[model samples]
Target: MAFSTPRVRAVRHALTAGLLAVAAGLSGMAQAQSSTPIKLLVGFPAGAGTDAIARMLGEKLKDELGTPIVVENRAGAGGQIAAQALKAAPADGHTLFLTHDHSISILPQVVKNPGFNPSNDFVPVAGFATFANVLAVSGATPAKTIDEYVKWVKTQRDGKDTIGVPAPGSIPEFLVKMIGDKYKLDLQAAPYRGSAPMTADMLGNQISAGIASVPDFIENHKAGKVRIVAVIGAKRQPLLPTIPTFSELGFPNLDDYPYYGVFAPVGTPQPVIDRFGTALQKVLAMPDIKQKLTTLGLNVAYEPQGQFAGRVRTYTQSWERIIQASGFVPK
Candidate 1:
């Protein structure tokens, strides 16, 4: 195996140099990650709550990761489109998906043969924050608390119990179903394209009650146009201290609420995922960002990559039962 020929020696030297050059280039790129812009793909329209959070996190992630982060809206199918897009993209860490439980967990349970598999096709990067789903009654409604609302719902005529939820299989819809079942209340569930439409209908008295994420109605509730009777959380949101959560109402099993987080495509290097998660956790710890998210009534939930991945698995299983229990069908 000893090659003394000049030609063999020259070939070996060229191969070693080529490998060194490649290694050096990779190291230089990692050092210059600040100059490369990262993409954050959201599965909702611009101006939506998820989009807003994405923008906020992007602003902070850009500062921490030293890379300019850009948010791209790929809206449709309760975030399935964005999830699908992530699955189709290369497993590079450059493209990231900032989505919630709906896109990753709920949608797949309802849809038949969804193109993307959340747990298998993606890796959880960081979990940022969580907001409760507030049970809001339109101004025209004559009830304020869950007890009163339950009584009112029972009194409604067969067709008068229309409750406007964001979508048929969304988290909000599932909440309404869970509570309605617990209280033995009759409700006619109605679906909307998004929270904006449902909020509008609630104001117009088209739907007696609406269940949406607290961020969607926080402003209107503050203005007194809509009232938050109950929030689905372990405790009241700090901004809405007076509003009692379902657990406070004695529904201990209904305490934990939905969460949102960032995910990278599968096969992404563990180092990149760790770096991204660390930078995001730091971003969540910033005082200014914390104040801003708190103003939107969201609690900081900066779970690291491992724990966040574990929660995703638990949430997926829990909601599989809830979705099937609700009998929600995509088509």
Candidate 2:
């Protein structure tokens, strides 16, 4: 038995085409595995402390991991949008969220359905730093001390005041309510998308005071544009040594510090998580890196994934009690 010339040629052509197709598929898979840039997602706009740190680490991580890293800002809804984005991303370790306590620890507790849960939807990659939030007043505000500010709010502002916050339902908002109750003044929170805008309002006297992390206000405070009157922590921060801690000011319950960290979508391989954790440790260990982050107001430190996750759990539980005591019903 023999095949016709046309049939034989057709069979050869089919075999050649099949081999070429398989090679192309393999090449595509290799490129997908090797060349796609890892995205470091931030829940706030660029120029805020979180975004600044993420970009800094992303630059160094490119060298450490020998791959390109892209910092993507998906800033909105108190980081809910970014958290949801992380949940929707593939669990291949290519996407990670860089956020602070507001998003990971507090948001889910406050919002009825935040679209994702930290324990269920994401895995901690590492913890980098802890920081205290500060209460800062505008340069034009006559008050300097927390006592003086309270007095001014009573006497100068007719017992009512508005303080800008970086986000609604954020720690700062709760602080606004607590401060009002403590001092017996009508204080309300004017929430902004991020600290940059909130600071801008404070500068223009659009809002007389604001509460945000030290890094957000440190530069301005040093410039004599914003006045940091009170800080929240067990001890006074080195950057604002003169400022009194809330504990010193008689509000001991608001002293727990918040953290900055990274997270990957759940189900990401542990080895990939470890690789990132190791790179982050190296980045945090550099003297220059530590100095820069310290200058930016982060108490630069590194915790591996397990320790980081535990910290998140503890912080979340603590805030849960605080929120309940405040009578805050989740929205």
Candidate of highest TM-score: 2
Clashes in predicted model 1: 0
Q: Model 1 Cα displacement at 88 (Å)?
A: 0.8
TM-score of 2: 0.89
lDDT (Cα atoms) of all candidates against the true structure? 0.81, 0.89
Model 2 regions more than 4 Å off? 1-33
Expressed as tens digits, the lDDT of each residue in 1-331 for candidate 1 is 7757999899999999988767655643573464667889999889988899899989988878788899999988788888989998877678899987788878888888779888789889888877788889887667878777777777765424778888777777777667776787666668888788889988888777898888899999899888899988777788888989888887645666678899989987666777788888888888999898888878887999888888888878877766676667765
Supply the global lDDT for candidate 2: 0.89
The digit string of per-residue lDDT tens for model 2 on 1-331 reads: 9667988899999999988767655543443457678899999888778888999999998888777899999988989999999999988878999999999999998899999988899999999999999999997678888998999888899999999999888899998998998899999999898899999989998899999999999999889898899999899998988899998978747767899999999987666788888989999999989999999999988999989889889888888888899898899
